[model samples]
Target chain A: MAINLKIENKAVVEKIAKLEEHLHLQALKGFFAEVADMTMFTLRFFKEALKPRYEFKELIKQAYLIGYKSFPLIAITGLIMGLVLTIQSRPTLAEFGAESWLPAMVAVSIVREIGPVITALIFAGKVGSGIGAELASMKVTEQIDAMEVSGINPFKYLVVTRIAAATFMLPVLVIASDAISMYGAYIGVNLKGDVTFHLFFLEVFDKLSFSDVFPALIKTVFFGFAVGLIGCFKGYNADKGTEGVGKSANAAVVYGSLMVFVIDMIAVQVTSLFS
Target chain B: MKKTTGNKVKLGIFVSASVILLITGIYFIGQRQQLFNNTFTISGIFKDINGLEVGNNVRFAGINVGVVEDIQQVTDSTVKVDMVIRDETRKFMKKNAKAIIGSDGLMGNQIVTIIPGPAGKAQVVDNDIIATAKTVSMDEILTKIKVTADNAAIITTDLAAVIDNIHAGKGTIGKLLMDSSMAGTVNDAMVNIKQAAGGLNQNMTAASHNFLLRGYFKKKEKKAQDKADEEKKASEKDKK
Candidate 1:
């Protein structure tokens, strides 16, 4: 009875070990698969972004959809962000009697870091989910497949244009958002103190330079690219039947946001290295 | 087709606006650097730069008229700084104008301040080496403050000793301030001076009445009376 029990115990342990190994391998495989899909999507963008057929009209529609249509939401969020940052930063700076540095401090934060990252996250939430769900539904209904059958390059038509739109539009949005945020910060500064609009802007820009503006603006392009590509990638490879749509949309946002921070970290390090 | 054209127009506008904003920003920054304007170069040699660096503004009478373009250490004590000034400001900057490395505010960045020379002096020519003043570095100021504080400490120590001596009635002033015997002596001296003064006043009155000095006094009095009578006669003649 002892020997039989030992054999059964050994067999159970082996089975459990094997199951653990399989789970680990599956996770590894999924990670690599996602990486491969992202790489492929990036390659497709490079291919279509340069080609002469230029979906110029579609690009415009996407820009309008991405930039103009999203203005009010971005404006509101930007104002709140500026106001809150100013109100919170006041006491800390006031302790040093450096309340005068408020505009410059707020400007740097908005231009260099906060404006891009927050705006991108907001974009991922709104646009990423929209693209993911819209494409997933189209994919489920076999519309993309139908387009392929009709000799349309669905990847170029759908993915590239949207990505291009995002890539171009995001920088514009960030600029507009930064301007609005500074204005908001001005209102915030004037809440307890006095600063003329011109002097406020002067102090803000006095501390700003190409190093702060260019690298920040440059990173937003990658941010837009990541947000648009991840959304499109998830939707492109979404499962059929019924349940995959919600999962794809959720993953798009989560991953898109994750990638923005990752890219931002790398960009900052590289900028610092050069600077 | 019409819809597509409209969309294209919209995109065109968006892209153009962003590009325009960016270009305008670039232009302003460039203008600040004096990239698009006519400019001239001038140099100054200083004993110390006071932490002034390239790209610091050069101010003339508190106006930003140029920027520090270069800085080179010539020796352990001297630094050579170059400035690129607007051509428009060149006429106002004389060869004798002095340059000093200063700060924007108490805690602000360092800038080269150009103190305009006398009005009659000629303008500084291109690449002219202008005079420089030794800029007071933060360390220098702190060192000076330390010296001053040390001197003040010594002075206070000496003063405290002096005050203690005065309180203890050890010196003349101390005796005057704190000694009861010294006060009594001063009172005696005051009484003696008052008596001597009264005696001198009586002696003067007796001398004035004596014959030897009295004729001189009488002659002086007669001259005064004659002058007074002459003045009265002149006044009466004018009235008549």
Candidate 2:
């Protein structure tokens, strides 16, 4: 008869525990490594951006593509967002007999938080994924290598132009979105209430100060930069396959959206500290 | 090429519109802060600012004529608030104008109200320190209310004790309110007063008609008749 010792069981449990601890440490290390790589990539891009042989035509084309092309989508989403927010907030405000405060309330919320965050998320979803996938495909098909061989910097041509376009376009998009959203809110207010456009805007502006607007707007620039940089960084360093293209796109969106919130949290804290 | 040019025009219009909107917003907000206007600075040193801050509206009379520009701690007990008043309102503001931190409403922003000084006083100059009146802060109001409420609570406790004594017939008010015997005594006094008043009226009438007083009344009547007769004779001689 063979005697069965439970030696494998004890060792297996210990090994599993050790593996978990190691995985946790590895995860932490990987996170730091990823951050370091992104930072270096961004620094390199900035260095490249400042150098001569600027891609002005490409930058303009990218702006046209990113900012002008994204208008319809941003506009529709903004309108819907404003309308929905108004409809939802009505009952609560009406309960307090502060329906008169609708425009100002909605204005503050949209300008200070909702407009920037929503626009950034949309930009991440649209431009972020586009940059990631486009660049990743270029890498996979060796177009980047061809460009590099032909006395052209792939980073400068693609990353710099795209990032610059995104950074500049996002504010434009936010401004348009904010205006459209306010119009939508005005429509929403008129649905159940009677408020003239001038009065509505007046009330909207009366409560809003510089503190509520500039910092909120300033953070959107960083948000755009983060999204563009992450997208470029992820795509440029993609793994050697079609699967990597998908991974790049996914990571760009995930990371871009995540960075928006993180930056927003920091912005809020800093704004509050000053304000 | 034509299509690209058209797209460029569209982009330009879009960018221009956005910039205009943004600039307009900035201008409005800046205007509220008294940034882009002809303004003069006036300040007030206050024992307490009562939660007044930079950008709080400064009202003259009932209208907003300026905005608070800065708040500085001059001493541990004093705060200096600098206000930028609109240039147009400078003539109306006198040297003796007072600044007081007050609220817009029961539940509204704290505003600095500039009480215009008496007419004929020199106009307020730029950077002139206006007189500051102490504001009753919410905390002080609450404290006073708390003291009042405590006093009211103590008084009510004493009142309740006094009322209890009245109910138990332990004091004068208690006896008057609660003692049936005291009520009976009051009723008996009232009855005795009524009876005494009737007797007094009869005695007064009997005294007025007594023989001892009749001679004096007759003498007064005879003197009245003689004086009337002399007056009639003098009138007849004048008529003759």
Candidate 3:
């Protein structure tokens, strides 16, 4: 009976020890593995990007589909973003009797931070899922293998073009969206007060410096790259089933958004170092 | 194939429009900073900039005509600020133009205001070191405000005490304002004054008509009549 008790006690201790190890070490282990995988994937992207087979024509097509197609939605979103932000910010600035500063304040808020972030998030939701599901469906149907057997460079045509399109197109979209949003802000400012278009733009230009603009612009490029890369990574590695398609689409948006915020944080820190 | 070309053209227009929009924005912002404009550089040495930064607007005659391009510490007590003013505004800036750091509003960013010098002075040239006036910093203004506020507080407190004294009927003014006894005293004094004036008038009238003074009064009347007669003759002669 004593021997049985000893064995039971020893087993209980071992179980607790195993539980502790899982709790303490497993999370760190998983995180490091994820980081390693991400780094390797990024390296693969760089390698694939420099590959010999060009996909210029496909890139233009994808650009049309991704950028041109996304404009109306992004434009509407941008307008709403500027209008809502201005309308919402009025009371706070009014409290300080700084209602005249509306143009500068709204312009800085939109151009520096909100325009790129909200647009990138929207882009991730729309384009990320679209790429993920399309690629995932192709993978599940073994169409990728069929293309490979048929002697076409599928990655160059498929992955590279889409990624490049997203990478280049986002900045264009952001620029357009920012301009439209400023126009929307002008309307917002005029809703309760009178400000001519000329004065409003002058006020905006007065406050915004190159430092305010260029860093924000450069970060959007990185945001575009991150969103596209994460989407491609998730979709291209999807399992060969219909369920994998759904998972890929969902993970694509989730990871893309997560990485956008992650990249924004890092970008802000680095930008602070310069200015 | 035709549809593809059409789509490509549409895409091209969109891309070009977007790039144009970006360039236009950059141009305007750059123009505000005197980056694209033909500009003339000028430097001012200030003891304190009062938080004036690079890219802060430099106003001339209440118009933003330049921007602060650089700020560097020249000495322990002096900071040199380089400015780039639009070439168009250069003609208005006199060689003796004074740069004073001022704020946009009561609570806005610091700006350097260029006060035009004497009208006869020559126009300022490029790279000229302009004169700088010692500006009152926000902290200094706040300190002055605090002192004024303190004085106000003391005055208000003293006023309150004076008001309380009036309410309690303490000082002469307090008594005048608040004391019913003082009011009655003033009323009695006024009545006494009125009686004294009446008595004095009576005495003067009695004295004027006294028997001893009757002769003197008659003599005075005769002299006055003679003078009136003489004045009348002179007036008649002048009229003639």
Residues A244-264, model 1: lDDT tens digits: 789889998999999999999
Docking verdict class for candidate 2: medium
What C-alpha lDDT, on a 0 to 100 scale, does residue A46 get in candidate 3? Answer: 73
TM-score of model number 3: 0.81
lDDT over C-alpha atoms for residue A49 of model 3: 77
Candidate 1 scores an iRMS of 2.0
i-RMSD of all predictions: 2.0, 1.0, 0.7
Which one wins on TM-score? 2
Q: At residue B182, give the lDDT of candidate 2.
A: 95
Best by lDDT: 2
Which is the winner by lDDT between candidate 1 and candidate 2?
A: 2
Give the lowest summed-lDDT range of ten residues in model 1 chain B.
Answer: B24-33
lDDT of 2 by residue, A1-275 (tens): 12344776778899999999999999999999998998899899889999998998789888899899999999999999898888888999898777888898899999999999999999999999999999999999999999999999889999999999999999899989998999999999999999898889878877889888899889999998999998998899888899999999999999999999999999999999998
Overall local distance difference test of candidate 1: 0.87
| Candidate order, lDDT descending | 2, 3, 1
Q: Candidate 2, which segments miss by more than 4 Å at Cα?
A: A1-5, A14-29, A87-100, B169-240
RMSD of each: 6.9, 5.8, 5.4
Better of 2 and 3 by lDDT: 2
Clashing residue pairs in candidate 1, if any? Answer: none
Compute each candidate's TM-score over C-alphas: 0.78, 0.82, 0.81
